[model samples]
Target: MGNTDKFEMIANIYDTPERIQIAKVSSDAIRECLVDAKSKNAIDFGCGTGLVGMNLLNDFKSILFLDTSQNMINQIKQKISSSNIQNAATLCFDFEKDSLSDLHADYIFMAQVLLHINDVELVLSRLYEVLKESGHLLIVDFDKNEKIVSDMVHNGFDQIELTEIMTKIGYRDIQSKTFYTGSKIFMGHDASLFILDSQK
Candidate 1:
């Protein structure tokens, strides 16, 4: 299956109520990162169903939601429409291959999206290019660990390795927070939230 097909296959399962709840928790964490920021323009990379955007709506003057999957963008559109979130735009684009010059934003968020990307450094470099100097990039994804072997198959990253990569790319004040998710019904994974400031 193609990359889009792989994501589409799990879109339905991810949109379920249970998964949405988990998304909300993740979104909350994202919001916390931007709580003190002064940026008004924001972009949600790989924005799925608008969960992260919804949480960050009030923090930014405008939010551009970009994703590789049309299905995912549709889901996000539905949520935005239902909530009447006016300051938002949805774009279909792949971060790995697409140029981000057309959509510059002060802050960029990629929740649970980086783990699925094969070239994390390339993605980070692109983000750095599109962001304004001193801009912030917040990434929330599953951290590398033995406890989440199954999840690692699809989405995973080594915290130390990723941190080194980000630092090499000129990111500063990089911090990662490790957390656990899931209860009895589902298997929880070790997730990490990374916040970095782009240096000029």
Candidate 2:
């Protein structure tokens, strides 16, 4: 199966305890980076089942959950309906094949999503375009790990290289730090997750 298909298959039960715990941390990280996001429009780019975004509804008044998988979008819709989450919305979107020219966000949160993307620079450039001036982009993903290699996913990333890419993409004040580590998280080996905060 492709990346979208594989995630779609797991949409129903994607919120495992470990994943939820990770999302909570990511939410907190975003909250810290964008302290006043409640007054801003937030986009949960590459959102999967709304775990990270939903947890952030209180912090961000309007949350747009965007994902490439329809099944993941369906699950987000279900969660919004069941929880009576009026401020949250879902969209089956893929920036790689769609346009974000009409939309802009003050805060863009991406958690555990970049490793699956093959063209990191292209994706970041699109995300930069979708952000409003002075907007904050929060990214939570695995740091470089040789033990977690995969054909369908990345082995993780180097923080310095990622920062350089963000700089080249016109983002200023870039910062990246590893905030979480877990065993058997990335391809059955211990992995550390880094949070990158960049200002547009």
Candidate 3:
């Protein structure tokens, strides 16, 4: 199955109580990452079901929620509309190929989605192009030190590898932290959060 198909399948199962708890943990980490940012213009890349966007409402004045799956975007739209989150916009577009249309954001967030991309470096480059000077890019995904499961399609890199890639792409002050100490059977690994700011 393709990425979108796999995502769609998961979306059906993601609404369970346990999954909602995990999503809350992820969203909390994302909220902590944006606490220091002064800019209000932000983009939540791969914003599945609007979890990240919902948590980010206080930090950012406006948010553009971009995701590859139309289903995912629809889910986010539903949540936003029902909750009256007026400062957000949902876009169904592939992050790799879509043009940013002269938009420069102060912060770009990609949580739990970087590993699924085929080319990490290229994705970083694309994100960098649309980021304003000294903009921060917060990436939260599975750390390589964590064990892999059979169902997971894409594998993640270690902190060193991720930091190297960010540095090579002209990002500075790269910092990483592991959020969850314990692991569950289904998740297969403890998740990590990486925070990096673009160099001026």
List the RMSD of every prediction in angstroms: 3.1, 1.4, 2.8
TM-score of 3: 0.85
The local lDDT score (0 to 100) that residue 188 gets in candidate 3 is 54
Cα TM-score per model: 0.83, 0.96, 0.85
Task: Give lDDT tens digits, candidate 1, residues 115-158.
Answer: 66767788888888888877788877765545554533444567
lDDT of 1 at 74: 82
Candidate 2: tens digits of C-alpha lDDT, residues 1-200: 12998998999988899888888888887778876776888999999988889888988779999999999999999989998888988788787665678989999989989988878888899999999999988999999998765899988889999999999999999999998888888878899999999999
Q: Please provide, for model 3 over 1-200, each residue's C-alpha lDDT reduced to its tens digit, 9 standing for 90 to 100.
A: 12776776676455666556656777677677665554478898887776766777778888998888888888888888888888889888885766666778888887677767876888888888888887788887766643564444455568788889889988887877777544552355554444433442
lDDT of 3: 0.72
User: How many residue pairs clash (N, CA or C atoms closer than 3 angstroms) in each of the candidate models, in the order given?
Assistant: 0, 0, 0
Better of 1 and 2 by TM-score: 2
Q: Give lDDT: candidate 2, residue 28.
A: 84
What ranges in model 2 sit over 4 Å off?
none
Give candidate 2's whole-model lDDT: 0.88
Give the winner by lDDT: 1 or 2.
2
RMSD of 3: 2.8
Error of 2 at 39 (Å): 0.7
